[model samples]
Target: MNLNIMGPLAVNELISMDTNLLLAFFIGVGSGFVLESCGFSSSRKLVGVFYGYDTVVLKVFFTGAITAMLGLLFFSLFGWIDLNLVYVNELFLWSTLIGGVVMGAGFITGGFCPGTSFCGAAIGKKDAMVFIIGLFIGVAIFMAGILCGRDYTRPHS
Candidate 1:
């Protein structure tokens, strides 16, 4: 397989925009399939993590993180990827902490993370469907706030 050594394949124009999108679509589908197969589409599996009954979700995520780290390392070693070209988002302390708390509450109550919610919805799970709807509503509200020039992270002073 050919690889781009300069930078991100799509970002550096090594691949066409259409190809990039197509690749992303396939990867998303594959990931969803894997999640469902691992029973991640079921909210019970994730909720078990919090209750100390099941730890598969936690294990899977930890494994994923380690796998990604090693993959990036190997890719860089082979000149297939350029670490310098990678973009990392800026860290916001308060927002990040608040978001984590909110997301944790959602996961405990709703039983699905953003990605697993979609995976569950794909299989016609009603609760997952509702979660997705609520997710979209939340996104719309957040976007509206942003469009209206409301900085949620700041005080009203």
Candidate 2:
């Protein structure tokens, strides 16, 4: 007996672009609300884990990661989703290592992760606003440097 099973509903086909955007907006707002409610929006609370005072962030992050991984594995196994269709970035060893190091350093020094910074900013925290501004400036400088380097390397004919 052959069992017919449909795997992975096509979201793009079912949802209009506007509706998708609206849903994303609502989800982001909900996530922000939850984070703020949990005190995750506070830099002091976030950095408490590093100081060995609080481990809520670490626990929640690990638990969420593990749960998502198990859910995906089960979904794939039961033919509810195709793992091959999942997006995965190509490995660039040196870039990945450098990025991780930079991000780790930033997190340690800033006392807030990007998500937490956004949440903090949402709640009118001045420090979080500064951090967010700094991030934007950093990105702008990086882009400018990249463009300059590319121009220098271009072949002039």
Candidate 3:
């Protein structure tokens, strides 16, 4: 018997778009529930990893990463997935460095990562709501700056 399971069901044409979207919605909800249950919705709990007061976040992050890597490796070995078909972002060193610095600054000053901010805000945390608002404002400002920069650099035609 021939069997093929080389990748995502969506890619394999085994799942309809509506079903995929519904599954994604449910998965997102489940993930949020898990995150809230694991105390990730709390800003203090998240920051505790940085302060050495709690390392659960770090441990959980690493465990998840390692598990994903191992699963991918095993799946490839078993011919269940095609590694070459995976989409990986092209590296831009300077942009990556700048983005990392900005993200780190936000994490330190805001006391909540983006994911936690959403989770916290979902649970009605005022600070998280403010952080999310600030994030949107920042994005707006950044877009404005980009638009201005583009116009300034455009050739007079």
| Top candidate, metric lDDT | 1
Q: Which one is best on TM-score?
A: 1
Off by over 4 Å in 3: 149-157
Candidate order by TM-score, highest to lowest? 1, 3, 2
Location of the lowest summed lDDT over 10 successive residues in candidate 1: 1-10
lDDT (tens digit, per residue) of candidate 1 on 51-132: 8999999889999889989998898898877888888766777777887899888888899988999988999889999999
Candidate 2, residues 1-157: lDDT per residue as tens digits?
5354433334424556787788889989888887898888898988889899988898878887899899999988877677776766766666677778888899889877789999999989999999998899877877897877753222332
Q: How well is each residue in 26-122 modelled by candidate 3, as lDDT tens digits?
A: 9899879878998888889888988999877898788878998999999888888777777666666666677788889999899888788999999
Candidate 1, position 42, lDDT: 90
Model 2 accuracy (lDDT, Cα)? 0.79
- Runs in model 2 deviating more than 4 A are 1-12, 150-157
* Local lDDT at 147 for model 3: 77
Residue 98 in candidate 2, Cα distance off native in Å = 1.0
lDDT of 3 at 11: 67
How many residue pairs clash (N, CA or C atoms closer than 3 angstroms) in each of the candidate models, in the order given? 0, 0, 0
lDDT (Cα, 0-100) at 56 in candidate 3 = 76
